[model samples]
Structures are given as structure tokens and as C-alpha cells.
Target: MPPKPSKPMMCNRKALPVAAKLKLIRKLEKGTSVAKLCEEYGVAQYCVNATASKSGKGLPRKHMKTARETGLDAAVLKWYVQERSVGINVHGVEIMSAANRLVHM
Candidate 1:
């Protein structure tokens, strides 16, 4: 039988960073054992699979998405990120306004 994780090992955490996930996946591709990787990285098997799946996406994954988050306009999110990269600090209200324009449905 698999050993039970300790109580401390069950502590809740934010989603692990993509870079860290990618690194773990890279190690796996290079022949590292999953059990050893999980132990070394303080993650579970679920995390390993999720990380691998998310690594190949064209978009970044958003963690803990709320029920109220359904109305997002992707173009606004993309433009917001691009503008931010060029040093623009956009507010939520601004994104909403822009989202309205981009969301034709």
C-alpha cells in the first residue's frame, strides 16, 4: 500500500508556478522517476499531470477561477498583458470597458 501523506503534507497552496512545473516535466522527460520528482518538488501525482498538460498550452493557466469569471474577453486580457509589458498599468474598470468593445456577442 502507498504510505499516507503526513498532515503537514496536506497544507493548501496556490498553484505551482509554470516554470517549476516545466522543470519537473523536463526532468521526467530526461528519465527521472515520478515518485522521486514528487518528493523532491513537494508536489503530488495530480500536480505532475496537471503541470504537464498545462505546459503545452498557448495561453497561461489561471488558477482558482471564480464562478463570476465567466464573462472575460480574451482579447482584452491579451492586450492588457501586452500593454503592461510596455509599462502600462491598466485598471479593472478599463479592462471591462475594453472588454465590452471586444466582446461582440
Candidate 2:
């Protein structure tokens, strides 16, 4: 008997560029069918649907830091500047230890 056909391997698809996503959204708005767009663009139906739903918003921007994190960043920057001004060779490990101490105090 002939061997059974093997299933194809699946791989992750690359994310579409903002321009491509915008084009897809425009086409969708112009009454293009989802299935037709999928075939034309070589993308999954979900990609088209998501792009249409989001209306070109794409991914959200990075979230804002909390007050504590903002304060920590400022304190670290100040300490780093001061260390450099005083001619002290500061390493990443030392910076991390300083942050730990600041957090504990």
C-alpha cells in the first residue's frame, strides 16, 4: 500500500507592515470580501478582520510608567550623572545595587 501523505509543517507568519495593513483596510472598506482579500494578500482571515476592526490603529503604544517607576528612573538618572561627574567608573551591577538600596530605603 502507498504511504499516507504527510501533513505540512506550520510556521509563524511575519507581521504585516503598517502600510500593507492600511491598504488592506482601504480595500476592505471598498467592499472587498474577506475571503477574497485573504487570497489576494496571502494573509489569514483574522489579520484582515483585525485590521478592519482596528481601522488602522495597529498595535497600541507602550503604556505609561507608574509613579513609582517614574521616580525610580529619575533617581537612577540623577545618580548616574553624579557618578560620571565625580569621575567614578560606574558599572551596570553597581547601578542595579544602588537602585535596590534606593527601593529599600
Highest TM-score: give the candidate number.
2
TM-score of each: 0.40, 0.50
Q: Tens digits of per-residue lDDT for model 2 on 1-105?
A: 999998554234748889988788888778889999887777777777777767744344346767658788889889999999999999999999999888887
> Which candidate gets the maximum lDDT versus the true structure?
2
Instruction: Point out the worst 10-residue segment of candidate 1 by lDDT.
Output: 57-66
Candidate 2 matches the true fold with a TM-score of 0.50
| Candidate 2 colliding pairs | none
Poorest 10 consecutive residues by lDDT, candidate 2: 56-65
Off by over 4 Å in 2: 1-22, 28-36, 46-56, 61-67
What lDDT tens digits, residue by residue, belong to model 1 across residues 8-79?
A: 554355367778877788987788877888777887866666676666632345567564444564567788
